[model samples]
Target: MHRFANPAQFNRLADAILPWATGAFVLLLGAGLYYAFFDSPPDYQQGESVRVMYIHVPAAWMAMFTYMVMAVASFTALVWRHPLALLAGRAAAPIGAVFTALALITGMLWGKPMWGTYWVWDGRLTSVLVLLFLYLGYMALWQAIDEEEKAGRAASILALVGVVNIPIIKFSVDWWSTLHQPASVMRLDGPTIDGSMLMPLLLMAGAYQAYFAVVFLWRMKLEINRRKLAVARQVSMHAPVGAE
Candidate 1:
């Protein structure tokens, strides 16, 4: 990890991998979407509206997963002062926020067909809403603090504190009654859902993970460049005006 901390080496690796990442993102999403819409059978209960599950569930999963990754990176930055970890957190925030929004929107669309409501204050839904707010607040703090070190430290603390909500969101249905459907796709009995539906869903999940990889690398590079420029300017300002 330390070896890759040098941005030159990191950039070289990212440059080599970016094309492969892009191709994987495109191909995986294309195949997943095609199978989701055309090949998967309609749910006996939800009918055609259930097709939205392929997109919605994957986005929701990635939203949570990305945040967890960001939180860990933030901790690494705060505790070990690992340079790459700071960049990782910055790269993940907006991407995680986008996935969280997608999950909420698609959940709403699916709800209207089944639950007859665009929104609800169920425990799972409300906890996820809190997750979105945490993402927004995390990004806001990073922007609000003008000093880079202060901002990163503050945001890292906030992320570690908010991680408690993640488990509550995952287990809300089990802990208490809720309007949202219980976990069918990831149950002890091994996916109560039929195989036809499962394949596209799993494929779309892979696509979402791939999408994160491509975007995260791109953003990390940009953040590193921005920080390097700031450092260079600081050095030039402090140098002796007429010294050789």
Candidate 2:
């Protein structure tokens, strides 16, 4: 972990992993789509609309997974002062927000056909919405503060505080009588879903994971360069007249 404290080392590592991440994302997405549409059978109850599950479930999972990543990175940044950890949290916020939003939208689309409505104040749905707000709030704190370290500190604290929400989102369906369905794929007894459906679902999930890695590495590198530029400008501004 201390070794990654050096930006140059992390940048080189990110570069090395980026190509493989991107390739995996493309291959997994292709395979997942093919399996989802052609290989997987339609839900006996939900009919063809079940197709949306391939996207919605994975997006929801990624949203929570990304938030967990941000929370852990935030903890590392706050506790160990890991430079890249702070940037990792910052880079993950927008991606998590996007995933949360995608989950919400797809859930609504899936809901309209099954539940006779496009929206609901169900436990699972509401908690997931709150997750989205948490992501937005995390990003907003960074923008609101002028000082970089202060901003990162504020964002990290918010992220740690928001950790409580993740479990609530996961258990909401079981804890309350909601329109949202309970867990099918992540059960302790091993996935309740059939093998045919499970294959594409897992594939899509793998694709989402790879996609996150590719984007995260790219964003981390961009943040590193942006910070470098900021430091250079600050030094130039404070330099003596004609000091080159």
Candidate 3:
């Protein structure tokens, strides 16, 4: 882990991985979409609307997953004082926020078809909404603070604090009476979803994960370069007027 702490090393690693991640994302997404729309059978109850689950579920999963990544990175930043860790947390925020929004929107689309309403105050729905807010708050905290270290510290604290929301989002259906469906694919015993539908779902999930990696690596590299540029500017400003 520490071997990759050096920005140059991390950047080289990222460059190596980016192409693979991008290719995987493209392949998986194509396969997932083919299976989702063309191959898989529709739900008996929900029929065509069930297709939304492919997008909604993966987005929701990524939302939580990205937050977990951010929180862990935040913990690493806070404890190890690694600039890479802090940059990682910062890089993940916007991605997580976008995924959260996609989940919410797709959930609402699915809800209207199945539940006969576009909005609900259900436990799962509400908890997911809160998760979105937490993402936004975390990003806003980063933007609100000017100093990189101070912003990283503040945002990292918020991220760690928001870690509690992940479980609540996961278990909201079981914890409270809600219209939201309970876990099917993630059961302790095994996934209950039929193999036909499961293949596409899993493919989509892989695509999402790959997409995240590609974007995250890009963002981390960008953040690192931006920080370097900022440091260069600071050094130039502080240098004697006639000195190099």
Candidate 4:
């Protein structure tokens, strides 16, 4: 881990890993989509609407995972001053934001026929909405600041502060009576969903995980290239300073 903290070492490892990740991402998503659309059983209550869960739940899970990745990376950046950690935060924000948006959009689409409304201020929905805003705010902070160091610092603090809301979002359904269904897959009493529905849900979750990996790696590679260009420009500008 420490060895890979060096950019040269990181690049070597990433170069080896990226191809494998790309292959696995495509393969897993293809299988997951097949299973989700064809293999899964419809719920007796929700009928076909439960199929939306195959997509919606996984998107929501990824949304939460993305923020946690950012928060942890932000902490690492602030504490150890690791550039990769900061890159991780930068790489994760937009991906997480996309997942959040997907979750909300899919939920709305699912909600309209089932819940009678496309929008709700219920506990779970509201908290998730706040999480989406947090991601947007984090990205905005990065773009708002001109100085790289200051921007990273500011973004790191904002990420850390927003982490307080993650737990709130997770437990919101449990804490309050809401339109959103309570936890079925992760409850203390074990999963309430039958195996027929569960398998596709798991497959879709894997697909979403692969999607996160693909996007995160792509963003990190882009950031590294951007940094290399900046360094090259700075070197060209300072060429005469030490030579003279």
Candidate 5:
């Protein structure tokens, strides 16, 4: 980990991995979509409307998964003072926000057909909404402060505090009576979903993970370059007029 701490080394590593990541993302996404739309059987109860689950479930998973990544990165930045950690947290914010929004939108679309309403105050729904707001607030904190280090510290703290919301989101379905369905795939008894549906679901999840990785690395690289440019300008401003 420390060996890749140098920006130049990290950039080289990113460049090497990016092409393969992008290729895998495209392949997996294509395969997942094919299975989701063409191969997977519809739910016995929900019928055609169940197809929306392919998108909604994976987005919800990634929404929480991305936050966990950000929180871990924040912890690293705060404790170990890892220079890239804060940048990673910042990079993940927008991606997580987008995934959260997708989850909400897809949930609404899925709900209208099954639940007779597009929106609900269900515990899981409300908690996931709160998770979305946390992502927005985390990103806003970074933009609100001008100093990079100060913003990173503030954002890191907020992220750490927001980590509490994750469990609330996860367990809300079990803890409260809600319109949302309880865990089928992750239950102690074993997955209730058929293998036909589960295969596509897992594939879509892989695609989403790959997509996040590619976008995250790109964002981190851009942030690092932006900081380097800022430092260069600051040095120039402080240099003697005739200095080379």
Candidate 6:
């Protein structure tokens, strides 16, 4: 891990991996969408509307997965003062926020057709709503501070604090009486879903993971470049007049 601490090494590694990651994302996403729309059978109860599960489940997984990534990065940044770790956490914020929004929106679309309502105050729903706010608050905290180090510290602290909510979101249905269904795919008894539906769901989940990798690498590279430029400008400003 420390080998990647050097910005130059990290940039080279990111460049090498990005093409493959992007290709995997595109391929998996296309295949997943095809299966979801055409190959996968409709639910016995929900009928055609069940197709939305492919998108909604994957987006929901990515939302939580991205937050976990950010929180882990934040922990590393805080504990080891790893520059790349801080940049990774910072870069992941917007991506996680976007995924969280997609989850909420797709969930509402699914909910409306099945539950006869677009929104509900169920434990799972409310916890996910809090997650969205947490994402926004994390980003807002970063932007609110002027200094980079200070911002990183503040955001990292908030991220660690907010991670407690992740378990709450995952187990809300089990822990409380809610409209949300209990775990189907991830349970002690294994997935209760059919193979036809599970395949597309897993495919879409892989696609979303690949997409996150591609985006996160791009953002991390951009952050590194931006920091380098800032340092260069600061050095120039402090240099003697006419000094190169």
What's the count of clashing pairs in each model shown? 0, 0, 0, 0, 0, 0
Alpha-carbon RMSD, each predicted model: 3.8, 4.0, 4.2, 4.2, 3.9, 4.0
lDDT of 1 by residue, 48-167 (tens): 998989999999999999999999999999999988788889889999999999999998898877777888666556767778999999999999999887887899889888897667
* Higher-scoring candidate on lDDT, 3 or 4: 3
Encode model 2's per-residue lDDT on 53-109: one tens digit a residue.
Answer: 999999999999999999999999999988888999999999999999999999999
Candidate lDDT scores, in order, read 0.84, 0.87, 0.87, 0.81, 0.85, 0.85
Residue 226 CA displacement from its true place in model 4, Å: 0.8
Quote the RMSD, in angstroms, for model 6.
Answer: 4.0
What lDDT score is found at residue 125 in candidate 5? 76
Per-residue C-alpha lDDT of model 5 across residues 168-204, encoded as one tens digit per residue:
6657744664334554222212338899998888889
Residue-level lDDT tens digits of model 6 in 1-244 = 2433599889999999999999999999999999999999998778999898888888888988999999999999999988888889999999999999999999899888777789866665677888899999999999999888789889999999999766766577446643444432222123378999988999999999999999999999998888788778887899999987
Lowest-scoring 10 consecutive residues by lDDT in candidate 5?
Answer: 182-191
Q: Which stretches of candidate 2 lie over 4 Å from their true place?
A: 1-5, 168-191, 242-244
Please write out the lDDT profile of model 3 over residues 28-90, one tens digit for every residue. 999999999999999777799879989989999999899999999999999999888999999
TM-scores, all candidates, are 0.88, 0.89, 0.89, 0.87, 0.89, 0.89
lDDT of 2: 0.87
Report how far residue 227 has shifted in candidate 2, in Å. 0.6
lDDT of 2 at 31: 99
Off by over 4 Å in 3: 1-5, 165-191
TM-score-better candidate, 4 vs 6: 6
Number of residue pairs clashing in candidate 3, backbone atoms closer than 3 angstroms, sequence gap of 3 or more or interchain:
0
